[model samples]
Target chain A: MSHHIVEFKNVSFCYPDGTQALKDISFRITHGESVGIIGANGAGKSTLLMHLNGYLMPTSGTVNIGDVYLTKKTQQEIRRKVGIVFQNSDDQLFMPTVYEDVAFGPLNLGLDEAAVRERVDFALNLVNGLELKNKPPHHLSCGQKSAVAIASVIAMEPDILAMDEPAANLDPRSRRLLINLLKTFEHSKIIASHDLDLIMDVCRRCIVVRDGAVAADGPVMEILTDKTLLEENHLELPLSLQR
Target chain B: MTFDTQYYNIGFLDQLSYKDTFVHRLDPRVKLVVTLLFLFTVISFSKYEIFALVPFFLYPVLLMTLGEIPFMFILKKVLLVSPFAVFIGIFNPLLDSGQVFIFNGFTISAGWLSFISILIKFTLTVSTALLLIATTSFPGVCHALRRLKLPAIFVSQLLFLYRYLFVLMEETMRIVRARNMRSFGERGKDMRIYVRLAGTLFLRAVERAERIYHAMLSRGFQGDMPTLKHFQIKSGDVFFALSALALLFVFRFFPATEILGRFVQGVFL
Candidate 1:
């Protein structure tokens, strides 16, 4: 009954070219849960994450965000509740300045300028990106651009946060900063990443996807340590767990 | 320098707009309107009327100084585009044989005079356009367009084009670098490789566009990108616009450059 919960019931999606990206995928993410989705390339992890906010509607079955079902009509409302941070920070931060990019979502929601400004400041402050507000996205370092990308989404103040490969391109230091930043977020978080160590650090639960279906679902540490399961899905144990 | 570094720094004019100065502070709409008027006034004169257009150079010079934009940078950009204008005007002297003028006891063709006029107009208009962007951020200008009641879609397209120009250039730089590294000396930089690379870049751009669209949709983008109207037309905007028009009016009708020339002659002779 929690409004922040996300549930998928037998969801299946096929790309227009007839590639079945997600096959009968069902999962439930309750409030305050942090989950990591792991899979090999082309395993439909991204396609599945795209469903949370209805960026891609399930060709069959249903996705529920909080109290309402996700449909063409409810996607806009669902988007306000479920914020998505894409893998490429460049694609997400498209506006002229960091300030305008962070304000984009709130402005799209028809918020007034004062309200948008407040949200932008709060979100940028949360990610320590306030000083970068005037800089163009291109001018930002990869780490700064990623932080602003997160701020752009979180400015909507969504209940659930989903990110695709949030730490993929960061340096070790920037990756550490990202982990620390992610730890401060109390929203229900779903992350799809190849970084099992990041998953172990930030997410308590782990979902392993293979061939567009759930291969394993368990606690992060348990799944990350299962050498056979990880190997079967073309993954390896977290570096910390290798020895 | 490397290709990408050069490609990256080309947008330095855009960076210059972020600097705080008198020209940068004016409302973008005011600058845009006045610049259009200046361009129109410069091109309206007869092709032989070089003296009037000579004074028009002051506008870009004033803007460059006030905006703190590097004079040489704008001049370099102006020169970069000079070949196109030069090509178009080059045939004038050869085709119009009878038009001639006697200047300082040397016979000068009227075609030469007209070509010079074209060159002047070209410099004035192109440099002013560059200065306008150098002073006003592109988004500021796009917002001005929206405020002026231009189609919202057109403005949004311009905004995206400006923002993605760097993104596209970076993508091209990567592909070029990859090709360079793979090719031993200068092999892959050929036309055939370039044509194939263009196709690859186009496909990649299309994919990136899809992802960008998905990102926009996830953030509740309806159809149009709604820009917040925060630009207030302050008194300085009006004063700037009015004084610019007054100056343009005076220089347009009066040969200010010739008068200055005569004044210098009277003093120095």
Candidate 2:
């Protein structure tokens, strides 16, 4: 039996201002699968990620995570299961101190103080920056802040980690470090990024989104190696990885 | 961008220590209560009541010395913000014309003394406010305000405003820098350009706020933010608050300075 963790069926979303963000999106993410969604700027990658965590209820169809339908009643539970790290680390890390930011998710989950501290330590250790616990988020380097943002979600121990543009605007070394850290997570991952190199390096499954619909979905190597399809969809294969 | 010459960066202040010192360890409710009470007792004296108000200065002095804050820094901030208070209080002398004291055989009206009293009160109150913030962080004050039974929505709004103000302000500063670098002097501050700049900043801020709301909702923020840490009042807090209150009461009610004057007079005569 296949263990499907997230299922979005015929999902369509339109902003309150009448801008359609996602259209008839149907996708199934199985347990422990690493999926990357690649698209242009306005291709609705963020809107889809929001749907996974129940931040946005689909205007048309249904979303399910581990047999539970996404609804107002199941929002808290769904959010606990699906952790989202936003594109901007500054937005994700709002607390005064690093430790507080890491512990924020677990504390919101109503975990005990001891358990929260343990989770915070575990998360900080995962980022390999335990010494930055006392430092403020604004004082951190861009890479460290991004790592702390990931650690903040990781502290909650969510089953699914959905990140948007996890490696955008980073130095090559920082980008390498982020990819290495992301490689260690065993949970089901959904990464939305324009960085085809990082996405191809980590994700085995690739989904191409264009004009608010899924244009193509298949193995990463096959999808990434197709130059004509990429150009047609306003995407270019990275020069280093192209045939 | 030209770097800001202002000494205190709000970003730098946010990262400072939140530990329990002799000051930080105080109960928030007690601190709020005592600060208010101290302000009231200092302000209640008659206009010509300089002698009585002299003893009240000791509270701020003790707070500064014990809290290990710089006295000059607090005084400078108080003095810097004093002109408005002075502007209001100066009218007292012009309105109230009552003669009370004869200094060197020239009668001086009580109105001037009262105006002076206002000046003293303004200095003390403003300094105390600065000292309170200097010693206690903004989050600590918000927690204190929450414990003091202030409106939860307002307190949380204050906390949220402080959290995002830095983020938004930094963004604003960057935009201003970019604009300035591209434009000449008059064009930089032009009305049309200013409106466009502000409009763009507002749009960015709204987008940021929307993202922040979603981020907050995902973390189980159901209208109220729950703080993980709890504050407990200790014996030191009680003793400190009570002793300060008792001292304020005695100073307000008794003519301790008059008695000291009498003793000095007796010694000199």
Candidate 3:
């Protein structure tokens, strides 16, 4: 049987304000797949990613990581299974220094100091952010902050990496760096971004969300090249393909 | 100017904390305990005693020089927040009119002596606290607090407060700047405008906090945050603390400055 890293079955979520953020969303990410989630703002891309780690529970359907269903009891394990990098790097990199932020997850898992340090180093090196180890998160440039945020998540060695709008607000050079870095990851990745060029470069498959539901899901080339599907979801073709 | 001053103060201290120096290298717990001890000794002086407090100035002065901190920067920060201490001490001269001593052959009131004492104490305490933050980063202090047996909740609360202070200041500064740009003098300074600004800032802060909490949860954060940098107290730390304690003890009980001054006078005469 092919291993599915993340599986969401008929999942629906409604916020306390009664806003339906996710509606009957169902998807399965196989091991080593790089999938892109694309949607306009408030189309439930982030809300869907939240369910991957049990940060948000599906109001109606089941969410699972591997064979383990997401529940309060399995939350800690599920969190280890799925790592999320939020849109705002500032919100994600909360610890004072870059090293501490990267070690935060593993330490919380009861890892010893040596193990945590090793993981932190490995993660920072993975993102080419080892130089930022001693720098305070707030003092870093936007690009550096995003790099540290990714390192913080990757240090936990999660099975699947889920990032929301990973390319937003990035300069072209940093954005290109991020795309290249994501391409080198061996773990499955689920990225939500409006940067279609980034999606094209990093993701093999794409899923478009609209009105709290999945509008389209297919191979990256097919979904992104379908101008009618892209236009209907309030998204545009990648700049490279626009002409 | 007030907003800018506050913004600059926060950034200035944060930048200064990163400098490499002897004081910054001391274990945070040792620095914390030593600072507290120094504060107690300074504040324990009698209300009318001014001469004895002179020696205690060495603690901050030495820290400033040894730590390579700019003296004028700290002084400016102290003066900026000195109003409350001044307000409290101002009434002392008016309430007590008894004669005390002669200065420059003119009689001085006891009230003046006590008021001066208050001002001295204020400067000593505030400057030391500021220096503590300048030399030791806020997270270092929070870690020290946790290791010192302060409630985990209390330490975490302080950590959260310090972390958000920057975010809050940035948001508030933006709002203030926008108001300044759109309104002329006296137009943007209305109470109603201030009220609305505060309300919006509060709402945005709450939303930002929610986002932060979710981000934290996504990374497997449980109730307590764990730190990787565990501070180990060294021989240098012990030596520093003990020596400061001994020196403070001497400054507290023995009038070394006066004795030294008298010795010099007698020798010269």
Candidate 4:
């Protein structure tokens, strides 16, 4: 059986303003593999993540999840298979309370209230965030907000998790907690972040994109060690790997 | 970070709503109807009828005491927003200077009496509105509106506005703080910088809404926000509504305060 769970088959995307955000991006993510995507600020990392769950349909080409090509008809199932966490916790945690935010996915899936409650509780407990269930998202500290955001997505139990800038704006303790939580997720992950230390700690393989196209794809250590590639892609070796 | 973020109390009323009390436990629809009726009765009084408005205060006072809400907090909040109503009412005494009442050889202008009535109405209406939210959650109010056959779009917009009010205020406060820090006493406080700051805030809000939409789409949101919790009206709700309506009827048609005052004077004499 093929281990691949996500495949980008020459997928290209363009914004409504005629800017080509992704240029025939092709890649495969095997099940349970964690990959780090490194790129410059506007190098299309987020656009690529958006395509995984069919939020933005490709201008050309196809995105397949478990051999099912992404289409309007299959979009529902595709979303269940892949969950994307945006960079900002505020954007993701839109519901009034943490419990409601976590239950949002399951309730939308038409699950019974009891089942939704169970899932929300489970997810919150998994993230050590059960105590935050009734608190409003706005009242939470920055770290708690990020944790609730992740729990909200995790409650859906998606097969693939894609996180954008998972560690940005988080203090050290929260970042460490996030890294440990991500490690516990038993699914394929694509983390696009500028936090090089986070990528090294959680990802074994790395992909570098420059100017809307893939610059390099190799083992994490090999890519981080290569000074020429790191500088070219607006990245650097993680602090742990320095010297 | 002294972000001047004192507006964090935007949800303080919401927190009060979660407390378990007889007022909070009543169905939101019942509370909504009673509050509206109370407001109507209070406003229906004549311009110079201050005695009739005295009895109307019982409804809000009952709610505050039953709901365990602090009277001082409600008073402070009411005072904060009273300036607008006070400004409008202040003109009544100034514009209309006709004598209406005589007490102990002193004459009071009809305009002053009307001005006092305006202040009374303002106190009753604003306090009732605040207490309604304090006892009934915002979602509860939105759910009641939806059940009352209000347009889904209107209720959802209200829900969104209430939910995001905190987020937007915090963001605005942060921007203002940054502006304050970078500029000297009067450097960046001009109207030009204010306009540009507002323009940037507007763009940021648009971008934030787009991201929120994307997040919703990824989670199976299809056109509507579905709520799992359902509301059912119970006998307690019906009883509460009936008693409130009875109070309104008695207070509206009967001069309870004037009769009580006359009885007190007769007994003393």
Which numbered prediction scores highest in lDDT against the true structure?
1
Q: DockQ of all candidates, in order?
A: 0.81, 0.60, 0.74, 0.66
lDDT of 1 by residue, B192-250 (tens): 99899999999999999999999999888877878765788899999999999999999
Which pairs clash inside model 4? none
User: What TM-score, over all chains together, does every model reach?
Assistant: 0.96, 0.91, 0.96, 0.93
* Tens digits of per-residue lDDT for model 3, A1-243: 355468888989999999999989888888899999999888999889888888888899999787899998998888888889999998998887888889889988889988998999999998899999998777889999999999999999988899998988899999999999999998899999898999999999999999888888899999999998998888888899988
DockQ of 1: 0.81
Candidate 4 per-residue lDDT, tens place, A51-127, comes to 88888899998898977899989999999888888899989988767888899899889899889989999999998
Which residue runs does candidate 3 get wrong by more than 4 Å? A1-4, B103-106, B184-186
DockQ of 2: 0.60
The number of clashing residue pairs in model 1 is: 1
**Per-residue C-alpha lDDT of model 2 across residues B1-269, encoded as one tens digit per residue:** 33453324444434333544697668766777788888888888876778788878888998888877766667666777888988987877778888876567787677888888888888888887766765676666777887777787888788777667777777888888888889885856878888998899999999988888887777766665555557788999889898998999889899878887999999999
TM-score of chain A of 1: 0.98
**Cα distance off (Å), candidate 3, residue B174:** 2.1
Off by over 4 Å in 1: B103-106, B262-269
Residue B96 displacement in candidate 1 (angstroms): 1.1
lDDT of 1: 0.90
Q: List the residue pairs that clash in candidate 1.
A: B99-B110
Interface RMSD of each: 0.9, 1.5, 1.1, 1.1
Q: What is the lDDT of residue B105 in candidate 1?
A: 70
Each model's lDDT: 0.90, 0.83, 0.89, 0.87
Pairing residues by index, what is the TM-score of model 4?
0.93
